[model samples]
Target: MSFAKAQDLLRLALMASTRHFGVSLEDIRAEFSVSHRTAQRMTDALELTFANVTKQTGSDRRSYWKVDDPTIAQLQPHQETAVEALEIASRRAKEEGRLRHAQALEDTRNGLMLRLSARDAKRAETDAEAVLEALGQVTRPGPRVPLNQKIADAVTEGLRGPFRLEIIYSGRSDQARTIEPYGLLLGPRSYLIAKQPDRGAELLNFRMDRIQSAKCLDEWFIPENGFSIENYAAQAFGAYHDPDQLKEVVWRFKPEAAERASEFRFHPKQTLQYQADGSLIVRFTAAGWLEMSWFLYEWGDAVEVIDPPELRDFVQGYQRADFPSLP
Candidate 1:
């Protein structure tokens, strides 16, 4: 067999061992960019080679093969890139104030390294250091709340179960409330996107830091039909979701800052129109004017809010001593 074919087989074997749901023939075909016949042959090869390879049918009635024995998939010398990526990610998470998450990543990296030879482990360390130095992180200085591991785990359970959470929130009110968890919006400051059934079907952002405790109830919830956390999060500038204030926002950048502004992914659905005068007009429909205002202040005189007079007023109002709150 060719060296490349051997490597592919090894990689496929490793993947099969790690994935709980196992791998499908379609998965093999997609992973290696092979034809259906080739994918079938690969599976046959795995069955012939690995004694512990077993096939199981899922709820969808589709059969997939899983390598029950994990030792069959050993770490190889060529997997330095994985180690480097993990190190970089760990450092970034630590810098971002996710200490617990960073430690978990570091632990995983260390465990993976231990599986390799001492020489390979040393080489991986050197390569990771080089990669980190070459690609340094530049983070915005802000309040990055470190999540409580217990609360985070509870929230995860609730989200995965589609279960209601009884949380002790310290934001605005010092009381416990039961909410149907939609999902979590992770960032410098994370939030739990959920709905208070007593209040209405409207979604609310509960700051993660303010959640003193979270208890996943035994009961499960019926998620709203056609509800997607990503789609909901995209409708806002940031975590603060206010459906009432949703508007078509427009901003114009001066000729000098146009190039800089063009490089920014301010919003997923944003569009840019470059003018003859070299100015750039950015347009996106979103909510969370407060968060948007915070970003706009950094641009100073280089940017102008052309649409949504309310937002323009809100931005200008900040300059006044008697500035009123957002409407």
Candidate 2:
């Protein structure tokens, strides 16, 4: 191994031994694949000086060195300092180009001193200030909803079963509606999948973002057999739609745009077929008209709806009304 690589390994060994096994020279050398002399040299090189080395005699009359340092006992240089220093340096490097040069200097000094270099210390202080500034900008100067804790309690209630919840849900129309929550759907975003008792059999999905408040009700509900949150959420494109209305909607992508569509499977049910003119045929079902509208809007002129005349008409109407001048 190179000298630098060997030094790194020796440093790691010393750190591990000091932190975990109370800094036994024999343990450091054996674990790090280094000579006793090399291990002794490493201990001497460390910034934190080891004091009171006691010689212990074992059953076989072998001698061992025991390190006694209260500082070593309290401060774990590797775990507490080194990793944090590297992270701070990396963040500063990304945000401020000039800071990277300073961070590099600090990292070198940290390797030698076993503490954050002066530059790294400054970077850390700057990071703290930046964090506080960002927090000040984003944080409202009023009481905020404890969303994470509320979600955790809701999840616990759902898992334990026999639970019903009342949530002040905001709809896509930005109308607030009160409903009894059936269960929660943990999606790319979290959702409360609740049945609108007033609406009758209409399963409404309330985005956690749009939910103003939720309260557990006195009544309990039993989830139906074969009902799964993952399966249900995966069936639709976005959180708002349902998957029960699966109808094969086909679209033809122009040759230039074909590769883009084929690059990633946009939907689990998506199927790609090459057309005669080198174009691509992408087929996937929509749970409702909402997802269909989104797909058509996103693909634009690069895609043409081939099947489901209603979808073609929907796109045509949008084109005529929205972009009448465009071909």
Candidate 3:
């Protein structure tokens, strides 16, 4: 009835036309943040407006709505901003050593270009490249460990299959191992989160650089029940994780640095308490004290360790060059 409603109906039509399996009532409700009744009304509106609209039942026994033609989903010639954004993201991904992600982004950009006429596609690409070149290279501070492209590709294929990975690791010993990949952790040093069935189901981090080679096995595996990469990663402040060394960490930031410190997300589960005197206290439960200490050094005298006497002792000892024994 309203302009906004008209726009929403058109947007819904575009989405329904573009998806291969069509969309369900649940999908409509979630996308539009509408109730079941509203979603049904919107679906009815789409059927009335689009001649190609059809309904089909899914394997789950739920009905799905699809449009036979995707004319409504076609991109506008003036909207080259989308292409430019994808180009920028691809370069950023490459700079971050995420070769797979960069390739995917580039592929998507080329696909979008193919949707246009040959001449228009060439013009769009030339313009996008010009914009990218003018922006110059982005230099990211900190060390970035280069990932082995072949090993990275193998890890990706293994995870997609939920298959086992046979890898040659150059850790303390150069040994061949078969592991189940859970996910990957990308940082200054990238790692593959996997578990060796022979060793047990406990997930461990294996440095990507140390993986001399990887191969995806034909065997499939059921992912661990209730296993979340985010939750596992949250257990540690950085890519490093040591379950046995887990502890509640506390840090107090001086007023001079409190504002800047509050802007940082030191940990996923970290909490902040603003002191009456303007100091800030950050607290979180995590392992990897060594990684945490590395970040603390950046704050210099602006921060102090409030608990975990061992961590305080370690930091203090490291600063004084005594290298105290850590528990």
Residue-by-residue lDDT tens digits, candidate 3, 11-42: 78877888999999999999999999999999
Name the 10 consecutive residues with the lowest summed lDDT in model 2. 318-327
What stretches of model 2 exceed 4 Å from their correct place? 1-156, 159-162, 170-190, 196-202, 217-220, 242-245, 317-327
The local lDDT score (0 to 100) that residue 47 gets in candidate 1 is 91
lDDT of 1 by residue, 1-327 (tens): 899888888888888998998998889989999999999999898899889999999888877999998886665536579888898888877765566678999999989888888888888888878877788566567877778878988888898898999999986886889999988788988988899999998888888988999999998999889988778888999877787779899999889889989999999989999999999999999998989999887777678888788889888744332323211
What is the TM-score of each predicted model, taking all chains together?
0.73, 0.46, 0.76
lDDT for each residue of candidate 2 in 1-327, tens digit (9 for 90 to 100): 578855554454445445533455676677767898987766555424434544456555554444544453443233334444555555544333234344565676456444555665666556655654454223323333223456446544644565666565555544544455555654335666767666876666766656665666667765566676666665666555744455677888788778777886766778899988989998876556566676567565777878677667767745222332221
Winning model by TM-score: 3
Instruction: Measure candidate 2: CA RMSD.
Output: 13.5
Flag the better candidate by TM-score, 1 or 2.
1
Ranking by TM-score: 3, 1, 2
Q: What is the C-alpha lDDT of each candidate?
A: 0.85, 0.58, 0.86
